[model samples]
Target: MSLSDKIKSNPSFKKIAHWLMIPTGQHRPRLWIRMIVNPFKHKRGKNSIIRYRTRLDVFPYNHFDLGERSVIEDFSTINNGVGDVFIGDRTIIGMGNVVIGPVKIGNDVMFAQNVAVSGLNHGYKDVTTPPSVQKVETAQITIGDNVWIGANSVITAGVTLGKHVIIGGGSVVTKSIPDYSVAVGNPAKVVKKYNFETNNWEKA
Candidate 1:
């Protein structure tokens, strides 16, 4: 059996491992300790840093995958309920962010504080049915490489962001954003697009 498999089956070892990972908040634990404890319970890659108090709510633990050198800051929550989350290499999930899958985040993506990304939406089509009791609709969210999402932004279900995209702070993304665009405001609109012919970014 693999080391992870063995560790999972051994209650005593698992307890010991968890104990060593108890965060003190004064100093971060070693990389190896994080690797062993894997508090997020995801299949993590090498050199990734998950700061103190970050939570990953993937029941089976195998539903989440984080790439190499990625960082999930403190107080962030990643939920993969009934879905999967795949984060590519060198991504940074800032503090106080909440990401709900099925969501695919490509390489070198950066999200500022308080950014919310969700792949599920509550269905309210039936007015007779209470909102709380309404069925939920699920969709896949795809974020391409080298994207930067500003602080306090909300990326709703079914939204896809292409590569080299930049979202302004406080923006609400409700649609697909094309590549090399700068989007901002509620129901985010593209304000700028890269002009390859001019070798610059120009007004959209």
Candidate 2:
């Protein structure tokens, strides 16, 4: 099913979805409290689990819609402020990574360390309000099936990647990418396309 269809299936997600829903600015302390107390408050179903030392800041509880058998590793922060975020089954969110919302991650996906996925970009046009005080611009980020996001990569808002896409380490993705493509570089570009016959990445 399509992502929109899948999201629509759960009506409860619309009610209480936000990062930092409460006004508590001391994120670290609140996170520690959850860690010490109900670590599973961020988790959805019984099969989903967060590994040790995983530090997730306050996020919309319903925004992180997890399928069965998913694991978020240590030091991973999922802060959903913009919109809904959904993680598919058997996906692994690596350590020291940060994922913000309005992002949908697919099944069997793997994210290496220090990966940053953010869907809300602060508005800078208004000089009266500081960047943080200015109106927040919202966008959606979509990662397709069997995708692998490499270490230290940053995925910005309004980007949609297709199925089986591979993002190399330390790349910054500012735009959308097509399916089955191997993308790399600063402001990531498609360097090669997958060749089924040769079983490798060939020049596009």
Candidate 3:
């Protein structure tokens, strides 16, 4: 097998790698890794603004890319420890947002305050092990262009939100939403769909 594959197959090596990326007893990356490694491994587009107060728990093992002119406002937390986080051009990640990756956000997306987009989930099937200590699972969450995610909305794991989609405030999205739709409420359901011939949004 190739060297990278071989390393992954070994659990001890994987543990060591995790330790190097993260600290001894913390979820966040070590200072050295953040300062030295991530800058070289990740991609940051031109004119992208990641505010100074933002908590970036990004690691070098996974891809973390910000597209051109995208802005991540203050108090936002982005973690790419388990998977890639890609945000397209001119996207605005508003204040107090939490984004955990394996997430792909398209261009011109607008996220309001306190939105949480997380693909990382903790396994709780093992009764003997605490959920916090159990293995974590991830699924990709895809968000398309010109989407607007309202305040306090949550886009859960493996959910796909298509282009021109709108998510209402305080919604908990658990399933995939197709293009040109509006979803709301807990376990968010599409309440509106764009009718082509009528050229208006009608009830779904």
**Largest TM-score belongs to which candidate?**
3
> Model 1, range 103-123, lDDT digits (tens) per residue?
999999999999999998888
Candidate 3 residue-wise lDDT, 1-204, digit = tens: 987677789999888887877778898999998899888988889999999999999988789999999999999999998889999999999999999999999999999999999999999999999999999999999999999999999999999999999999999999999999999999899999999999999999
Write candidate 2's Cα lDDT for 73-190 as tens digits.
Answer: 8888876545777899988888898988888999989999999999989899987779987888978899998999999999999999899999999999999999899899998999
**Highest lDDT among the candidates is held by which one?**
3
How good is model 2 by TM-score?
0.78
* Model 2 lDDT-worst window of ten: 14-23
Error of 3 at 70 (Å): 0.2
Worst 10 residues of 3 by lDDT: 16-25
Extract clashing residue pairs from model 2: 54-75
Rank by lDDT (best first)? 3, 1, 2
The C-alpha local distance difference test score for the whole of candidate 2 amounts to: 0.78
User: CA lDDT of 54 in candidate 2?
Assistant: 72
**TM-score of candidate 1 versus the correct structure, residues matched by position:** 0.78
